[model samples]
Target: MTAVVEQPPAQPKVKAGGGERGLIDLVLRFREAGILGALVVLVAVTTVINPRFLSAQGVEDIFLNASILALLAVGQTLVVVTRNIDLSVGSVVGLVAFVVGDFVSGTQHGVLVAVALGVAIGAACGLVNGLLVSFCGVPALVVTLGTLYVIQGLNHYIAHGEQISAAEVPGAILSLGNGDLLGIPYLPLISVAVMLAVGYYLRSYSSGREFYAIGSSPEAARLAGIPIRRRVLTAYLAAGVLAGLAGTLWLARFGTVVADPARGWELDVVAAVVVGGVAIVGGVGTVYGAALGALLITTIGSVLVVLKINPFWQEAIVGLLLLLAISADRLVALRLARVLRKRNVRHG
Candidate 1:
């Protein structure tokens, strides 16, 4: 009897109840679903308030406007998933846009060169950011903030109070930007392609999964022999490259390129990321969710215009939504914690 009792004690013990863990997983999986539901609700309400909001032309404008922002948000999602931030993305976009404009302004460099230049510039900027954060051990927020200012200043110096006018922009690039496919604009189509590609990588690759591991627990990530610094560097580089791509699109969409286009867009992208269900502290979010958040914000702007509400009220609404998302996340985490505790006590 004594030996049998000792053997029972030697058995492996199960930890937290699966019910709690399962619930948490469900919440995580449904992050994008929740955002989608919210989007549906908002669209339905707006469509009812102003039937014209759903008109074909109105819908086109909304998707077109959201595309650039959605692309930025997708890039931002990658970095945030690794538990980092990139404040300089907007500045990078502005700088790259001006450069691309100057490169092809009066020349026949074509859209391909402009595309390559934008992505290269953005990637270089991201590499710098990643290196500084990874090697120098600087906090991401501080490093990115500094880069933002530096890039913005550099952009002004390069432009020197000059701007790229519509006449200077190449027709091919502009045509590509303005072109549509089967009733869908090019911008949204590009944004969707990028989002789907990145989303697939993050979902399917082991390297991509490491991002979440790092964000969830850096210590554990390190212990598991994951190269935290390299992963982080890659994340920032991807963001910078995407920002560059957006810059190209910006120049194409709005031929009048100025020194400070896309200024102050950092906060907007971050807001979209947060509202899309990506935790600000890191490790939990999908590019899909972020894209949806971007679309939703742009839609809100359109809705406001159609409803004749104060234009400035859109910001207020977005801020409120962000706050609500954070609060909900906190509540869910607390409930999970309580459940784990109860399960432990019961098992004991």
Candidate 2:
């Protein structure tokens, strides 16, 4: 009589689908893994064709070339994650590089003062950009594009067709750029530090997570009590600061600054961000991925030079890769959605 009622079978647990979860995790990582694989293959082939491609000097050159772009890509990632773009970054870099170089060239300012000035200049630009996009309700593309021309004009007027020469750069600043720690170059070290810091913040903080939320669905984010305007403004400010820092580094690395030093580079930055797995559609990407994408872009150019390929083909190859990346991202997203749907229904 006590056992008259049979016990119902227990519902299956979600942990039962561990295999599916693992697979989903792997799929999520496919973008970074694929880019890494491509990089390894490209480097191997280029090194085989010209062993000097992996030589010490060649390696140094590649890192140096990738550093500034990687830094800019990191900043762009912040903005793009929130469904916005900053076309003015290249102009900001150019202006900062010119102004900082000119200031240091004329004054006895040390490296610290020069860097502080550069960062301040960058902050000012970021504030302007943030105010326009956040408060005025202007589209990011329009706002940044307009600022691009304004910054370029200011740079040209300030330059008056003059350029900063190598001799004008201070020894300490040059050391900061070109010096090494235990045989590791400083430029790459700086870039790595920055990428790590930003990456960590984005991964671990609520405020950072809000960026993706806003990008994924603005209305939902707003309903969740997220401050969309503040987040978006912060993104633009971060981008501006990074661009400024990149400008200072540019001067240090090249020891020469022109009014339009970074012209046409905005396209390259966007391309790298896209190829690095940050969706132009927003709400998907990582700084680490963006940095790798920058490296891949920079490496392709070096590989071409090593293989003695025509320089013109460099841009073409980049475009092809961009298209392929976009297609692959689409496929992955579709597959992920299907898998997630199946998992949800099964578990439910």
Candidate 3:
């Protein structure tokens, strides 16, 4: 009476449909495609309005001006993609810039040493932020908000109503800030390199893909054995390093540092990241889009000046653009959800 049981047949894999609807479905799944289109339109319109916008010198100026902001936006994109935010980057930038200026102006320090000190200080501050948020289990917004005040206060205390002037900074460092390579500024070139590195990592590496997975659905990611906490801490750490790098660049460019050098810049950085198609709730974005967003915002500011529009209008325009971006994000999310629901229903 040794009887054998029969096994069921294997189910066939269902091939995905191929057509315009499929293409639309793909686009809806990634909201970045739409933002990319918008960025192209913005560039075209700006170039049309002022052909000078495409001039070599003008293009270099735009890239140079957008460089630091693009760096900050990339960091902001990482945090936002993790469903978190860091409000302390502006203060971090100011503090690090001031520190580097102080060191460079001091009798004992040189350009390289000053840059190293500033970067180290920035990393320390970011480490504190990461620890507070990741280990203490505090909300990132709350922790960074507190750190913002703390860091700003530290900056004021250290500065003690003093400012470092451009005259005191070394010529070499100043050159770093102002010099161009083959018609492109060094800072913008560095920013592009960073964007490319980060973009490649997030798109191609396993650990990088894990970040997207975690952002897309933390619970599912956890169940799938992803190291969620470590990944988040790593994201914050990367952000902090970039913030430090930006501080160094700011120091080089301005050749002067004040306690409030980049005050309120976090808003612009966050806005750029959001406008670049990084979801506030997490999961989607690219450094290229973030850079484009930075360029767009910077261009709008320049256009305002060129058109003789009030500077206040620049801020207003940024606000409107952010609102529009958020609205578009929500609409796309809704469409994707509806499509997913229909697909699930049909499959079930």
Could you give me the TM-score of model 2 versus the true structure? Answer: 0.91
The true-versus-predicted C-alpha distance at residue 20 of model 3, in Å, is 16
**lDDT digits (tens) for residues 43-113 of candidate 2:** 99888988889999999999999999999999999999898999999999999999999989855678888
TM-score of each candidate? 0.91, 0.91, 0.88
Candidate 3 regions exceeding 4 Å error are 1-55, 106-111
Segments of candidate 1 deviating more than 4 angstroms:
1-21
Q: Residues 135-203, candidate 1, lDDT per residue (tens digit)?
A: 889999999999999999999999999999989988988976788888678998899999999999987
Ranking by TM-score: 1, 2, 3
Report the lDDT tens digits of candidate 3 across residue range 1-348: 999989977543222235423644365345566656765786688789777767777777777889999999988877777788899999999999998888777454556776677678878878888888877899999999999999999999999999999888888888889998886689989999999999899878888877777777777777677778888888888888899989989988888787879998988898888887777788767777888788889988877766677999988988998898888778877876787678778888
Q: lDDT of model 3 at residue 94?
A: 95
CA error at residue 60 for candidate 1, angstroms: 1.1
**Judged by lDDT relative to the true structure, which candidate is superior, 1 or 3?**
1
